[model samples]
Target: MGMKYSDGFSKQLPTLATVGAALVSLYLMSQAMKSIPVGTAYSIWTGIGALGVATLGIFLFGDRASAPRLACIGLIVAGVIGL
Candidate 1:
């Protein structure tokens, strides 16, 4: 949605915000790595991100929530929990 904004100030603000968010996410992951194994932390981080984005796409962007897609999301949740 932010990326859909026109060029100039509008685009710059969203871009900056995105960069800031990515930086913060990395920082948090690094902090988590202090106690959790790197591989486990990274997997869980990516899995949760994927699940969140997919869920948001369904509710916010009217993306299809088909049975297969939902199953895949469930699998992601299971994998994250397994790790």
Candidate 2:
């Protein structure tokens, strides 16, 4: 019973972490954007979040790095950097 509960929680950890990170990020970014622009704020937020998720997927989930996956991840990284 304890093992099952722990397993379930473990399964949900990454999703929960992403949500938590996004919430924190949005609030912080909003504050920074108050004196700036929405377009800029959204660009930064989405690009950074995409890069973060891809990194987490690779590091935590033992995800594959096939050619297509690598290409997509590269695009995301470029977006983050370009932003």
Residue range 32-58, candidate 1, lDDT tens digits? 999999999999999988998899889
lDDT minimum window of 10 residues, candidate 2: 1-10
Estimated TM-score per prediction?
A: 0.85, 0.62
Q: Taking the tens digit of each residue's C-alpha lDDT, what string does model 2 give over 1-83?
A: 22233465575766576567667877899897988688877887777766766677777777776889888878877876676
Clashing pairs in 1: none
Candidate 2 steric clashes: 0
Question: Cα lDDT of model 1 overall?
Answer: 0.86
Task: Find the candidate with the highest TM-score and give its number.
Answer: 1
Q: 18, model 2: CA deviation in Å?
A: 6.4
